[model samples]
Target: MHGPSPRRPPMRAGSLRDGMTSRRDRMNHVVLTGDRPTGPLHLGHYFGSLANRVRLQDTYEMYVLIADYQVITDRDLPGSIQRNITELLLDYLAVGIDPAKVIVFQHSAIPELNQLLLPFLSLVSVAELSRNPTVKDEIAHSSQQAVSGLMYTYPVHQAADILFCKGTLVPVGRDQLPHVEVTRLVARRFNERYGEVFPLPEAMMGEQPLLKGLDGGKMSKSRGNAIALSATEDETAALIRKARTDSERLITFDETNRPEVANLLTLAGLCLGRAPRDIADEIGYGGAAALKRLVTEAVNEFLRPIRKRRAEHTEGDVRRILAEGNERARERAVITLGEVRDAMGF
Candidate 1:
């Protein structure tokens, strides 16, 4: 016989502060996660995770971060860095991310938040930093002479980002579980060593299967496998046009054998909310050219309204939205920073 269904544990005392809050407190539990914003949101973004962020906004207190400083950890160019912050925000607004629901703020704005970083560094050892899989993977990829201290201790920095907000839940993809684990470790050490000032944020992990790029490899902008969310219809159409496919005239979605075709089918599936195989079968009967054409049309059509919405926006509007987001973020940051100061006996 099946056992009783698992129950959600009671919300912590901090979450109970909602009893004092207005607006039904749908935000009893806060969720925090962000892209490094090294580049714009891309097609793989839509298929895998953007829709979930849109939906989760109503369910959790959300903070969508422009990790402007973190971007410099990997990419050190100044001009590219400044341009990306604006472009990343534009991408966020284009894809129906409401600033009212989800705060869209930059890391640089909350300058005081960096103080948490120093204490966090002391909690984790140099050996622990060297062993972090992400740092190792990044170092492996780059034959650069020296891995910067920021990049090496990036996990602790991530912990600062999460704990600073006292975030209770963080929605992250599975590959990032290790990072979340590191944050939890920091929380445990902090509470044990200092005080229970920050919540051990739980990983509300994203179950969305990792979306691969058109080349069937990891979806990344640098790889040229990306379809940028802000790209024009003509631009998106051209990218899809160049999307690699199999030699055969006939088409069937076999992700293992025909990953390129399957990737396209998956994109179509995400838009129409159907299984990739099902969409593949419906369109495959007309042969490869037809399948390609159908996907191109559907994707462009789907992106059309979003791009228009983006176009209608102005820099002033974006600045205003970010200003609102910044204020909301700063309000929370003030409380947490105050608590941190008290904890450290300042």
Candidate 2:
């Protein structure tokens, strides 16, 4: 049941190794997810996670983070860290994630997340942190001699993100399973080293498969294969035209044989709530050009409402909403910090 599955940790279970039983079943439900605010949310993000966030908002005390601190690990500029906050909010609003029910907050505003980072860093050895491939990959890619301290301890910031809210579930993709494990280890180690102040958050893996970019690679901004939610209809159509489909005159959707066409089909499927194969069948013998046309239409139609809503969210209003949400988040966070200080005689 295991491979290089990244030393995965499940909530309510890690204490088994430490011989400390937890009453996790009796606790109230809290869920957390969001972005680093380095850029806008693309279809990959929307298809992969945003819609489900709307549903989760109803069932959980949802807390969405604009992880500004995490962006410095990869980002080159500091200005985007500040501007992307409003851009991220618009993306969230465009995707139908209701801010009323959810706490839309930023990492910088909640100083408790950074404060929690200190004790958490002490709980785990550097050897344990080095074992995480994410950090290793980051260090390998960095322009610096050694990675920045934030890059090295990104997982701890994430651990702080989840535990500060005492969040029990983090909705994420498969690539992020390791980060969740790091968070779980951090939580368990903190509790073992200190007191049981935070719950170990489980990774509530999303049902949606990873959507591919037009270039037939995993969807990412760095790769230039993503379809940004903020893109115009003409822009999407033009991008689809350049999508790296096979030379097969007739369009077919087999991810193994034709990943480019499959990517387009998958995008259409997510928008229409149909299986990719079904969309593939519908486009049978229609030719790659026709498939591209169909996909462009679907994506443009899907984004119509989103773009409209985004336009309505003026910069000032976006700031006001984030400011209000940040205040609410800080209120909850400061309360948690006060308890931690009291518990530790700080």
Candidate 3:
């Protein structure tokens, strides 16, 4: 069911390449980035996008959305969503995503946001939606025997998520490039047909866009291959111990031939801020056990401060943060919806 990886396209707007002398110059760029509260975030989440968000919050008008409404697209229950949202907030704060600089809100909080979906749904064809590789990949991997209506129109809902807030930049992995493209198309079409209301959002990628799972596949919480940010020190060490590595005694960072080992190396490299190959050379002939030990140490040390900050937060704090962010998001959504309505003569 896995499809060929798509080539990463150049950013259509908000190219960080443009020289901006001051923070004031960067303030005009708006960034929409977030995660589904399906489970707690993992190291892959850290290196892939969360890390970039931490860095981007200072420069851009950042909106970190917890896509709670999208949880129902593939699942039947919403029981754990509340818990997952709390965990996500804790992870965000621990990783230096300042609530003051970034608006972290849930999907269902802003009614006006969802109101944009109806108009956006009209902007794209069913064929275009079906052609989205990210949606197709999700459908192919989903547990549901039949794709739900919500799952089919997931990209359009995402378009609402981005356009409702006038998001000009979206931080995404390569797999998600298509979804951002869908948002761009929706914005372009809405502006062209109606008036210039939405900005064509661009996709921003991190140095490490996709991190492999411990088993050398996609890193996912459901698959039990990811080490959650909430994981205790012992839990992280145990997970790293069980990470799949080849029998070759010499450790090397060859992503093509030795992906499992290379994944572990990548984890360690990301944690220690060093080249994976250099780490490999240092641990040459040490085999998988030594490599795992190094990774375990690096990961635990890196997460020590983050996990400590995470534990210091109470559920009430998370709720309050969400409430404030939801209010902010609603204010923005109301303005955008008014513009859309005026353009459509609604």
Best candidate per TM-score, number?
3
lDDT of 1: 0.71
TM-score of each: 0.84, 0.86, 0.91
What pairs collide in candidate 2?
A: none
Compared with the true structure, the alpha-carbon lDDT of candidate 2 equals 0.74
Better of 1 and 3 by lDDT: 3
Error of 2 at 267 (Å): 1.4
Per-residue error for 303 in candidate 2, Å, reads: 1.3
lDDT winner: 3
lDDT of 2 by residue, 237-281 (tens): 998888877767766668787877888887887676677888878
Q: How far is candidate 3 from the true structure (C-alpha RMSD, Å)?
A: 5.6
Residue-wise C-alpha lDDT for candidate 3, range 20-123, written one tens digit per residue? 23445446878998989988898877766666677677778899999999988876676588888998888888877888888999999988878999999998
Sliding window of 10 residues with minimal summed lDDT for model 2: 1-10
- Model 1, position 231, has a per-residue lDDT of 80
Rank list by lDDT:
3, 2, 1
Model 1, backbone clash pairs (residues 3+ apart or across chains), number: 0
Model 2, which residues run further than 4 Å from truth? Answer: 1-27, 136-146
